[model samples]
Target: MVKARSVVQRIHLLQLALQITFRRTPLGVGMQNECWGAVAAELARLRGETVVAYYGISLREFRELIKGNKLTPAVMRNRVMGFRTLRFAVEV
Candidate 1:
């Protein structure tokens, strides 16, 4: 059975996965594309959830979501709570 992870925990896990993925020096386009799935799988493992639970979309869709500034850390925090809409606030 999978243990439940808190919102903060999930967000932190995602951040770490992104950092790890970005730090890699992939050799080619193919390898670079594969990084997305790698990160998703890593995140799923950390959260004790299936990759589909975090991102039910295809790898391309997930990549676009991240690259298009659609999925920020703040937005992910809301997503963990079942909120789909993105929210932004001036951090002070």
Candidate 2:
């Protein structure tokens, strides 16, 4: 339960960070606005349902990366959902 809460907190932090950093840019606008959609897709994938796309990743790959501690800030930067979670953060 504690671990689950931490994961939830991390997601929230990432979400807020994204909103603060990127909400105004075109890319950030699209990603931040659709962040919830990414979460929903992940849920569907968890249920073993077929998904066209989940957070910029295929269901299988998403499942694999999430295992153990594979999901990290660096890994998130490389993953679509991470960006989607914190989508629109960090300007180039």
TM-score of 2: 0.22
Measured by lDDT, the strongest candidate is 1
Which stretches of model 1 miss by more than 4 angstroms? 1-22, 27-34, 55-60, 63-92
User: Whole-model Cα lDDT per candidate?
Assistant: 0.41, 0.37
> Best candidate, TM-score-wise?
1
Q: Could you tell me which 10 consecutive residues in candidate 1 have the lowest summed lDDT? A: 83-92
Give lDDT tens digits, candidate 1, residues 5-90.
Answer: 44654564446444543443431122244333455556667878665455333455445534532233432432321222121111
RMSD of each: 10.1, 14.1
**What is residue 86's positional error in candidate 2, in angstroms?**
8.0
